[model samples]
Target: MSQPDSVTFADIEVAAKRLAGIAHHTPVITSRTINQHTGSQVFFKCKNFQRTGSFKFRGAYNALAQLRLEQQQTGAIAYSSGNHAQAVALAGQLLNIPTTIVMPEDAPTVKQAATRGYGAEVILYNRSETNREELAQTLAQQRNLTIIPPYDHPHIIAAQGTAAKELIKEVGELDLLLVCCGGGGLLSGSAIASQTLSPKCKVIGVEPERADDATRSFHSKILYSVNNPDTIADGARTPSLGKITFPLVLDYVDNMVTVSEEAIIRTMFFLWQRLKIVVEPTGVLAAAALLEGVVKAPQAKIGVVISGGNVDLKGLGHKIMNYEL
Candidate 1:
């Protein structure tokens, strides 16, 4: 999928309309400490507070809503680590469709259970030997299920754009906006939205150092992937950029930066300790960029997308405590 010459303002508006009552119009949070420390008045679009504890729900529900009648009846299948799986599962439940999710055997138990609790049938595969895409395709072919790609579809991008629409409505205008990149759905949608809503604002993407596909793709002007990433940010661990989203990121995204695993972990804990928000590792990368000075904010305004909050408490505690162990 080549890059779209332009993802228009109307496209984003339509997406906002499609997601109007279905997806959460999540709140924008402000903190005096964040403002003082970052040296900018930060507006955090807290999708972590969104249903399914991730912004993935917005895109998933929107994509599901746009599916043809036949596709809906046929049901949908997806492969995801956690948040996206749960989002698709919940969306399928709400739309009264059968959902099947292929997750790695090593995926966080909390996330796996949450997806199942949403009424989707969960299939576990060996992360090391099986390719998730191949598994998803096999299932789709066998079950006659429509594949709802995690972040590659236009409908998904449109749906994700609504978060920016809501943010701009609440924060007026921003000089710079930061979003964490996984498969580039949220980042691509954010670029489209920021371009439309605040034309002068620069949209940047943050990624974990271990899964810096977006950053590499931006510099190489080609798509990149990590076959098997080793990071705690499971949501941002897509092996490659989508054919559609890669071009979108290359063309529209102003900059892409990476943060260290330690930085990501520190930022996650900072939000938990200071902002009193429980965010997943991927969700914390934007804040990590700010805290680590990966990209200094432009003075006008700053908006950061806090993507998800579905961390396993016991596991997270273990990670934090056992860092040196």
Candidate 2:
């Protein structure tokens, strides 16, 4: 198992301190009905309530905060499907550094608008024809900006580690930790923090069936890609495992699982109606995995991190009404 470079418990402890007032100490929420149905006590880390409405803010802000003075003045750029784009935009706005986001032209309009609303310049490219990495590279050369990747950097991972560290602090000794995976930043960081802080807790990553690259990669012991996903969980439509994140997940993650789009939509509806929480399809998929029996809930106390709440409401009703896997 290839682990992250010599990250000790003390490293995550330091990250928690640095991230103390910066990242929101999102609450651990529970529902009696969910607990009764699953036959397991559950603690939900509601990162949906985090700044920029996702856990990405924790890592993005942390990475930006650690940058050298020159790097801060030179500004930063990122390529994301949605949540990370908003994270970087908001981080840059607070740090007073210029930020540019290169995103798929077909990203959720709400997320794109939110990124722009933060005053970051938004660049859109065709998903099919233009490679975002190549475009970001070219832009970096021309504009001299640091490209803060969505999930593949250590500083970013350390920032993400703060969420799980806080969760363990609030609800001690969970038996299992579940997190939704797009490019694996949240899961990787959670794994590192969980292994170090709550060593006995088994960490699992959840994904939509249509965008199950992490699951495939874990099973094959090789990095995998699922470019051009057709899932409703648009936030998780990344094509592959990130370079830094892949090894971390392979080493520390206990397992990776998938849920159908139908299950995801059903869980989204349940969360909205029953939990009164507005979770995006990607965020709801971990609960959906449990609901669909893709994940056995016999592991005593299980913690699921609800990632983000950036769903598009305009066509949601129609999709949830007649959606299929």
Candidate 3:
């Protein structure tokens, strides 16, 4: 197990305090139907209802809120497919810090519009032709802007851990906790929180099967990566875990699993109908794992983190119309 002494429960507490009154203490909901189907006491931590419609707001706000005056004046740059872009943009707006985001040209139109709506200047690039990180770094240097990385930063990870902290505080200890894995920020962060608050809980990270880099890395205990996987879950389309997140995930997370694209879409639609919540495909990955029996723990207490709900309705309608599941 590789441990970097990275994020800790104490850090999450600090972030929670920082985010208090500013960030919504998102609610946790339960489903009797889901509980009956899984035969477990299921708790759904709904980050979808958070500001910017995702949990990314916690990290983005925490990181930006703690910036030095100079950094705030110079502003910051971030590169994200969707959620992080909107998060940073909104956070920057709240903190009066200018933000520039490098996003894929094909990123969800809703996300792109939200980022711009938050007042950040968005630079779109072809994912096949350009590396967003390098572009952000170059822009950062040229503009004297800070690079607020989407994940892998200690502040970001600690900030993200606050979601699981809130969940555990609300629901008490759990037997199993399932988290959606993107670049491993939320996964690793949630595991860290579960470790301290619910020592007996087993934390598992779930991803889309088409973008299973984290799963591969977890099983082999070796860093693995993908190159712009074509999964409908845009958030999980990250190439791989980061230097910070990879080690944190290897050390803290108990297991990793991946669900099919069909499972993801099916779960999203199911949640919309059953829970009456609009969960994006990426947001429902952890729920899919539990609902579809990809990772089962019969009769045990379970917690599933719904990461976000920023769906492109038009695109999702097309996907739903075409999907058999």
Candidate 4:
């Protein structure tokens, strides 16, 4: 199938088939404690159990798998703060394609090590000083590598939708579906899937208060970008949504909400303590919104996408032990 700028529910279905047997059908988890606290029935789509420890693997693998044989032979390139880097690297290794990733120098050490451990050449740059996209493009051209962006492409969006598709399939139907938004890929994709599979579901995107470009854009109906925001949710520190994802979000997403950094940390701790799941900060965006009652639909059936589990264990432990954000 030829790639398009925008993705559809059919495209997401095709991606699901393509990923069959390759990607894990991650579990849908529930916490009675959480339900009691929020006064809602919540199902958590645990993408943290996904390969490469994040939902990013779904998109990365799908994109790379569709490349021309010649392109695969040449290699693939990507830029990410952490999870996407590891996703692309692991996908390339599985497909016997050389992969190169550009990551911020100050990215979580565990993520950096995991990306390199997946057999990809890791290039670190100062995020504040260098533009990662431009650097990745230059390297891709020089090395004849195909660029598989983190969340800007059709394949990525479609593949990411499979998470919600699986969630809805497992849980029947939901009144609301909450997703963590970074570049809007997962939110857009999930919106499309929910529109098809559960038309009554109101899709909501959640982000850190610091990285509220998506929230602003959703409200204003105009795309906006923000510089690097200092938030503990490193996975969601994206500057803005991409061209491909923006329109889908605007049309299909019902609402957008922002959670404070403290709310995010508190949610993460709750997940670890009550749910027995170690979700990263970004993964807790949706849960934070629900727990904080930022967007309330009392007694509603809700689905929350736990995006990833790539936490820096030592750092997270320290923060939790000391009640630090």
Most accurate candidate by lDDT: 3
Top candidate on TM-score is 3
Assess candidate 4 and give its lDDT. 0.93
Relative to the unseen true structure, what is the C-alpha lDDT of residue 273 in candidate 3, on a scale of 0 to 100?
97
TM-score (C-alpha) between model 3 and the true structure: 0.98
The lowest-lDDT stretch of 10 consecutive residues in candidate 2 is 1-10
Q: List ranges where model 1 is wrong by over 4 Å.
A: 1-7, 321-325
Off by over 4 Å in 3: 1-5
Task: Return the lDDT, model 3, position 139.
Answer: 97
Candidate 1, residue 37: the lDDT equals 87
TM-score of each: 0.96, 0.95, 0.98, 0.97
Using TM-score as the measure, name the better of candidate 1 and candidate 3: 3
The collision pairs in model 1 are: none
Model 2: residue 91 alpha-carbon error in angstroms: 0.7
Clashes of each: 0, 0, 0, 0
Residue-by-residue lDDT tens digits, candidate 1, 210-290: 988878989998777788888889888898888888888887899999999888988888899988888888898998999
**Candidate 1 C-alpha error for residue 222, in Å:** 1.9
Return the TM-score for candidate 2, rounded to 2 decimals. Answer: 0.95
Q: What digit string (tens of lDDT, one per residue) describes model 2 on residues 1-325?
A: 4455534456567777877777788878899988888889988888899999988898888888888899999999999988999999999998898999999998888899999999899999998999899999999989999999998888787778777888888989889888888888888888888997788999989998999999999989989998789898988888888878888888889999998888898888888888899899988877887767788867489888899899879856666666664
